[model samples]
Target: MRPLVYEQTRFSPRVIFDAGNGVFEMEGTLMLEDNKVFFQTINRWWRIYQQSPNPQTKIVCKLNYYTLATDNFLMQWLYVLKDIPNVELIWYYNPDDWEMQEYATTYQSNYSFVKLKEEKVR
Candidate 1:
C-alpha cells in the first residue's frame, strides 16, 4: 500500500504515514468537523501498516491543540496501536500546555502496550 498523506486544514491536523520508512507523524491542531471520516482514514492506514510493520515503528504526535470532540477518535486510534508490535508514541506539547500533557498522561494510562514518551516543546 502507498503512504497516506492528508494535508492539514485550519481545523485539522496534517497526517503523514510513511509505511516504507516506518515514520508516522501527526502535527498541527485537530478540530475537524467530521472526525469520523478523518479518523477512518487513519484507521485504514494503520491496519495496512500492521500487515508487515517495521521492526521499530515510531509515531510522532505534535498536535498544538484539539477539540473535545476529538478525544474519542484519538483514544480509539491509540488503542489500535497497542496491538501493533514495537510501537512507540512520542507526544510533544508546549511546555506550558498542561492540557496536552494531561491528554498524554491519559493515553499512557489507557494504552500500556505502546511505549509513550512526553516531550516539552516551545
Candidate 2:
C-alpha cells in the first residue's frame, strides 16, 4: 500500500504512514482546534490499519510538551491502540519525563513496544 501522508499545521499534529517499513509515525505539538477534523484523520487511518493490519505497527507519541487540554483529549488516540489484535505498538517516551513511568497501566496495550528511552523529543 502506498503510505498516507497527513500534513501538519501549527495546531495540527504531523502524521506519516510508512506502509513499506511497517511504521506509522505521528509527532508534533498536540493542540488541534477542531477535534472532529483532527480525530477524523486519525480514525480514517486507523480504519485502514484495521483492514491492512501489519504484523508490527509503531505508534510514536513523540510530543515535546502538549497542553493540559490536549492531554485530556489524547486518550482518544490512545484508545485507538488499546486492543489492536495483532499489531505491535511502540509508545516511546523520553526517559527524562518522570510522568511516563507513573502511568504505566495507561498503556497496557501491547506494552512491550512502550519503551522509555533517552532520546530527543522531535
Candidate 3:
C-alpha cells in the first residue's frame, strides 16, 4: 500500500504514515468538527498499517494543543500502537507542562529511559 499523507488545516492536524520510513508523525492542531470523520481516517490508517506492516514504527505526537476530545482520540491512537509490539511512540511535551510528566510515566516504565545517541550503525 502507498504511504498515507493528510495535509493540515487550521483546526485539524497533519497525518503522515510512511511505511517505508517506518515513521508515523502527527503534528499541528486538533479540533475535529465531525468526530466520526476524525476517528475513521486515523483508525483506518492504523488498521491497515497492522496488516503486512513494517517491523518497526516510530510515532510522534507533537501537538500544540490537545483538547479533551482529542485526548479520547489519542486513546484510540495509542490502542493502535499497543497492537503492534514493535511500535515505538515518542510523545514530546514541553518541559514546563508538568501535567505531561504523568503521561510520560504511563507510557514508559521507570527503567525505560536510557541515554540515546544518534549514529548510523552497520
Candidate 4:
C-alpha cells in the first residue's frame, strides 16, 4: 500500500503512515475544529493495509497537545490494531507532562498492545 503522510499544521499533527516499512508515526499538536476530513484518508488507508499487514507493525505517537476529538479518534484507531497480530503501539510523553503521561497510561491499560515511554530529550 502507498504511504500516507501529512505535514504538521497549526491545527493538526504530522502523520507518517508508511506501510512499506511498517512505520506509522504521528507527532505535534492536534487541535483541529473538525478531524473527520483530516482522518478520513487515514481511516481508508488503514482499512486497506489491514487486508495485508506487515508481519510486524509499529505505531508511534508523540503529541504535545490534542483535542478531545483527536483523543476519540486515537482510541478508535488503536482499537483497529487490536486484531492485528504483532502490532506494537508506543505512546511517548514528555517527562514533565503529567497529563500526557496519564493519557498514555490510560491507553496502555485499555489496549494490551500499547506501550508507554517517556520522551528522551535530544
- Flag regions of model 3 displaced more than 4 Å: 99-122
Q: Model 1 over residues 2-101: C-alpha lDDT tens digits?
A: 9999898888788899988766899888887899999998998898888888998888888889988999999989877887898888877776778887
CA displacement after TM-score superposition, residue 57 of candidate 3 (Å): 1.1
Tens-digit per-residue lDDT, 1-122, candidate 2? 66777677776667787767777777766676666666667766676777767776666666655555665455666667655665554555556665643443355432554554446665
Q: Candidate 2 lDDT (Cα, whole model)?
A: 0.62
C-alpha local distance difference test of each model: 0.83, 0.62, 0.65, 0.83
lDDT score of residue 98 within candidate 2: 56
Best by TM-score: 4
| Worst 10-residue lDDT window, candidate 2 | 101-110
TM-score of 4: 0.91
Candidate 1 local distance difference test against the native: 0.83
Compute each candidate's TM-score over C-alphas. Answer: 0.90, 0.69, 0.76, 0.91
Location of the lowest summed lDDT over 10 successive residues in candidate 1 = 113-122
Pairs in clash, predicted candidate 4: none
Residue 81, candidate 1: Cα error in Å is: 0.6
Residue 53, candidate 4: Cα error in Å is 0.5
Best by lDDT: 4
Candidate 1 Cα RMSD (Å): 1.8
Error of 1 at 48 (Å): 1.6
Worst 10 residues of 4 by lDDT: 113-122
Q: For model 3, name the residue pairs that clash.
A: none
